[model samples]
Target: MPQPVLSLDALRALDAIARKGSFAAAAEALYKVPSALSYTIAKLEQDLGVQLFDRSRQRAQLTSAGLLLLEQGRELLQASQRLEEQVRQLDSGWEQRLRIVVDTIMPWAPLWQLSADFTALERFTRLQFSEQVMAGTWEALLRDRCDMALGLAGEGVNAQVELHLLGYAEFAFAVPPTHPLAQRVATTPDEPVRREELLAFTAVVVADSAAEMPGRDSGLFAAGHVLQVPTMQAKIAAQLAGIGVGFLPVHLIQQELLTQQLVVLTTEIPRAPVPLYLGWRKDVVTGQACRWWREHLLNLPWQQLLTPGELKAHV
Candidate 1:
């Protein structure tokens, strides 16, 4: 890789000059002589062959090139400062970074609150969240793509991960009230919907986000056509639009059920509640930050809807 022509010192000097609005003032703020700051800028300009400042002006003002550098340079400065802080705080047993993968079926509003609560601890661990589907959630930990996973299915339990049963999410076969299936359920009221009759309709299913592993889907009962959506929201939207029919998380569609926009139909063969899991890599030693997250998140409503009742105490 080519060596950078501009150093951190050069960026700092440029930033200070721009912010302080004068070489003398910037030098004072930096605890250096005015000429020292001048020499640093001059050296940077010489190496890059760019006129960083307009000397023709009475007061020190940056040229167009200098303004662009300052724009990107400030971001670099903030990143460097954060890196320094993380390095300094590493002895506290907090990870420098924490990557979490959540299944798309889980509600995200609670997770956002969980992240905010983590930030309040000020551990200097950078938190990242990714939403995956089915096998994709499990593979994230297997591939070491993320530090921890929430809503992993119990199908592929391995030595690589330590998992906890988050809980079972009850699913219902919901379709828009205008749908033929809904009308059929309304007419019969007592008889369970036959699986063979469902074979003629389209089923909306959440597509597994697995990149390397084989993708798998759930709650599909031999629908003649399949419409795979990226997330639960899309699946819900598809069902609400009367375009397809499939099982959906009961908790997620409470409002639709209450409003009569969507109605749940009894099936001849009912889908068992799906088990969701919380998992992390077993190979690596966990840090305080990881443990902290594990504790807080387990208490939040991953097992239930994105409710505030449990999340408030943790937050």
Candidate 2:
């Protein structure tokens, strides 16, 4: 007998089934009937002469062999997709998809209007958005996970990417009015709280979004206990609940400051404003769609883009 040959269609069927959880669901995704997938996968199994999915489970759980095949198969599928996308860009100036990653500190509502404006152009490009915190923004760009990064922060950006400064943002050390820090500031309004005193209390900080690489700590000291939250919003919530104290973006907590839901505590040394940037990989071809997005984002006012709209409403 000859060795088994794998077809793209069969691989697609295998991928869809594994991802979608069941044959019926995969069929729906592939726009084919359940029977068709079952038949195709069955034929593949016959050709390979090995079990892929364990039949004993209710869901289409892959066997060890199937998982191995899938791991490689997904890479092939992704390459094929990239090839197709490149072809589309060559034929037309627009990319089929543009991935945009924004720092969590950046407010996304402004882009909602811009997205609607882009649709008016009738460009075939699709917009995808992701939010990253601190070093995670840089990591996403370095990992080739995103086409464009907005509000990216840190020291000098990587040489591989073109960087544009959006603006600088100031952070305020905020805590609930009932917290000791608040009382300290209120009693001695002129004096800034020392680092030792600040570190003695728990710090609420946003967890960095990077997965493979170790993420950097943004605001906390080595000696202090930390309350880690996934996003800036969560950190704000933690601070408002008086769980911990740390510097938060001033623009983000305007409403909280106004309503006294959270109050600013002066620190011994104020944090210097962080410079936010817009960046994209230097080597990757910048298609028209990507350029359009980059230009549009760069044109927006940084303060306006970062400010939470309902600062009138507190935590």
Candidate 3:
């Protein structure tokens, strides 16, 4: 006899039974009778010339061959679903991709969750993310490098660009436990440490991501040695290694602070929380994906969203 052609229905029946752990449960989930599911499974096994189930057990149990088929069948089913979703996405007028620029200081825990949710929608809109610092986020938008930006400085507000207030990020002055500043803070926490002492150590600063636009130097001092790193994570690592000392976002180093890996020092110049903004060009026509992001970000609670430790738990 010619080999029987397999169908999605048969594969689906097998997967459901394996996942649900019993024929009765699988039948209920598929909204079919127990006998119907059993028939499908039996037909599939016969077509493949294999005994799929060991019927001697009280509960439906798969044989070795049955488990192999079940594993492969689940993968096939997922691919089939993706194929259908891509078709639907083509039918809709969704954008092919979205480019988002996120500032280095922006907490990424919530953004990661947002990306996961977007993927679940199966809109087929590819998300491209790039990291920037300070002015670089704004420069990306102005250079037409990104569709949207988060944690941008408020300077040079464009009339054609829409801005959303994302609240302030508190910057804490931190150094490794072995750093000179950490050792010098013998007095009460309220008393200001000399600025000259702070200027003595090298400061770890993140390089701006801007290309054409003039980059910014936010925390650098004239007298101090400068260690310019490419990213915020690098700066964090550098500070932890006692390479330099600088202000870091409290949200990003909560764990370090709690573990005593980094010590907060009293400074004559206390860095205030920096206010960040979300921005996108208003003149350009936006696709559904862009609109979705704008709507979500505009309404997001900045304080809760930017708190890394709090958001990481839920993610």
Best by TM-score: 1
* Runs of candidate 2 exceeding 4 Å displacement: 1-90, 303-315
Candidate achieving the largest lDDT: 1
lDDT of each: 0.83, 0.82, 0.80
Q: Can you write out model 1's per-residue Cα lDDT over 175-260, one digit (the tens) per residue?
A: 87778877777777777779898888998989888899998876667879999889988999999998898988877777787787
Q: RMSD, model 1, all Cα superposed? A: 5.8
Q: Measured by TM-score, how close is model 3 to the native structure? A: 0.69
TM-score of each: 0.76, 0.66, 0.69
lDDT of 3: 0.80
Error of 1 at 265 (Å): 1.5
**Residue 240, model 3: Cα distance from true site in angstroms:** 0.9
Model 2: per-residue Cα lDDT at residue 166? 82
Model 1 global lDDT (CA atoms, 0 to 1):
0.83
